[model samples]
Target: MSAEIAPQPLLQVNNIEVVYDHVILVLKGVSLQVNHGSIVALLGANGAGKSTTLKAISNLLRAERGDVTKGSITFEGRQIGKSDAPQLVRRGIIQVMEGRRCFEHLSVEEDLMTGAYTRRDGRAAIKQDLEMVFNYFPRLTTRKSTKTGYISGGEQQMVAIGRALMARPKLMLLDEPSMGLAPQLVEEIFQIIVRLNREENVSILLAEQNVNRALKVADFAYILENGRVVLDGDAETIRKNEDVREFYLGLTEIGKKSYRDVKHYRRRKRWLA
Candidate 1:
């Protein structure tokens, strides 16, 4: 007998409209899909409903104040829009929310254990998973017993991502993972995400403002503007699109070529000098 093939499309978000108080519409009609073992990016500026879309998928929408008014979110071929956040975790869909929401009072290791609250695995397996996280983020292991509030921001971000991993998710919703990090640290975090996608085969739906970096890593990308998906295509195609460059990239027709030529000129000037 042959080994069974894993199912495709770990998560799918189709035409989701999120509204606040039945008056304000944040996401007009956002549709996105993430295949198994691929990295996808949702690129948009602030207030573009990127985070709201993530909340809708994770079923963390504030029901009394905000909610998904229409459309469906499916995880592993099952509808999950109405499911609660904890139920989503049990379904192997987890979100590493924006702002690196860590338990400041809890120790690093303790915080990670919170993710395993729904796990039915044995304690020994949980322990081994903890060690695996330690290997991926060595700093977390060094500060395992330290309170999360005392750790550096980069370390805290690692703790947040590690905590999500502890749940053994098939798909991760990463909201602004590069937010508030130093330039070097942002690069470091992106590399780690790439590694996670490749090594663990974990699908990722990344909401990011750092287009230059996010497009480099994502296989597919969607560009949202004012609550609508204005552009959707393969990463490389979007990267090279003239319209995307002019509008979203903040570079005009001639401006795009000027950037390239300027770099060439600087390199030549250095060689001559």
Candidate 2:
């Protein structure tokens, strides 16, 4: 009998360090991988270098005066050294930023159309993609004519994701898609994300603060603290970890505690030793 071959990663970040404005060192020896057709979560508190990691992969750090000072990043078997962000997008890697950025003045449909800028496909294909985005986010169809700024926060978030979808990405770098939305909306978005992963076969690298939700949807996960990867494992293993349960999930044998208190308690975890 023949042995099974392990598949290569769709994206790889190896021991990368990021620095800002030539002085502020941010990411410290961060490394992770996203395999084809899988959802990998990057979990951390605010300022934990989650977003910076995504930027490093997409090569967006240059615009922010940040540079990868060490290590390497590879995508689809090619090294991405000093690659341009737009070129990355053209290569089917797209990033949906943290804030759900939208063109306030542009109509909802127009905002989505911007995602297709890199494509050389015809108008018919673009129209088909627009309908596909609307199918995933039915609310966007209803607000197609509205100015993006006039829509609800949840709707704005949908627009952001829909816009990224318009790019026809093979790999999506999603940063904090759950932030600032209602619990229901967050769940809704994550369901759609899972559908996109399973149904559309798109690979995902997600940076998220909502540990519980992210773990539920992700295949593999990495936990970051103070700009470094402190722990990582398969989702089930991570969820069962005592420290993760206490610090991130806000769950303990006793009850849920404030995250502020949890942050202080994390210093004593064996993983940090």
Candidate 3:
């Protein structure tokens, strides 16, 4: 029998550095990969360059006067360092940005239709995909005609995800899908994220802070501090790591710390050494 060849990852971000203007370094030597049919989580604090990394991949950094100063990002076999955002979107990479940025004036269905704007596929295919989104987010079915701003926060988050689904993405960059929602809604969103990966075969690169929730859905995880990847491993292993359990998960040998204490406690990360 012949030796089988291992396949390359669906997306690869290699030792990338990002900067705003000609100064202000953001990401430094940060590299990670998302394999086909897998979810990879980028776990970090607020200023840890998580969003900057996603914006770099989606080529959205330029809008904010940011640029990838070093290294490269590739999707499949293509080097996409200079590719425009629309080009990436057409190439089947979609980014659902944080804060549920829906078209508030537009109806829920209309907001979703915008995702297919780059598609050359016929209207029939588009309509079918719209229904597919609806199937995945049944809550949006009744709210289809409602303006996005009029819906509840949870419903708007659903619209944001549904809109991305309409793009028929090969890979989805989800930035904090659980941000600012109630605990119950956060659980629901992550459940749908898993279904999208397993059932629809969409690979995910998620930038998140909710380590506990993110670990439940991620296959692999990379922890970021400042502008660098400090540690990475399989999600199960990360969940049990003593450092992770203490700093991010609020678990200590003493006991679980309250959110107030955990947030205030200075993070003495050994990973930085």
Cα RMSD of all models vs. native, in order, equals: 8.1, 3.0, 3.4
lDDT of 1 by residue, 1-273 (tens): 001233557778899999998899998899998888888899988998898988888877884478899899888888887789898899888999999999999999999999888999989988998998898898677898999999999998999999999999989999999999999989888989989888887789999998888999998899887777878888999999876665567766674466677668535633542
Q: Put down candidate 2 lDDT per residue, 1-273, tens digits, no spaces.
A: 001233678888999999999999999899998888889999999999999999999889998999999999988889986789999999889999999999999999999999999999899999999999999998888899999999999999999998999999999999999999999999999999999998888899999999999999998999999888989988889999988887788678867777677757776553563
> For model 3, how big is the CA root-mean-square deviation?
3.4
Worst 10 residues of 2 by lDDT: 1-10
Clashes of each: 0, 0, 0
Residue 126, model 3: lDDT of 99
- Provide the TM-score for each candidate, comma-separated: 0.88, 0.93, 0.93
After TM-score superposition, what is the CA distance of residue 141 in candidate 2 from its true location, in Å? 1.1
lDDT of 3 by residue, 1-273 (tens): 001232888889999999999799999889998888898999998999999999999999999999999999999978999899999999999999999999999999999999998999999999999999999988889998999999998998899998988889999999999999999999999999999999999999999999999998899999988998988998999999987888888778877768676656545453432
Q: What C-alpha lDDT values do all the predictions have?
A: 0.86, 0.90, 0.90
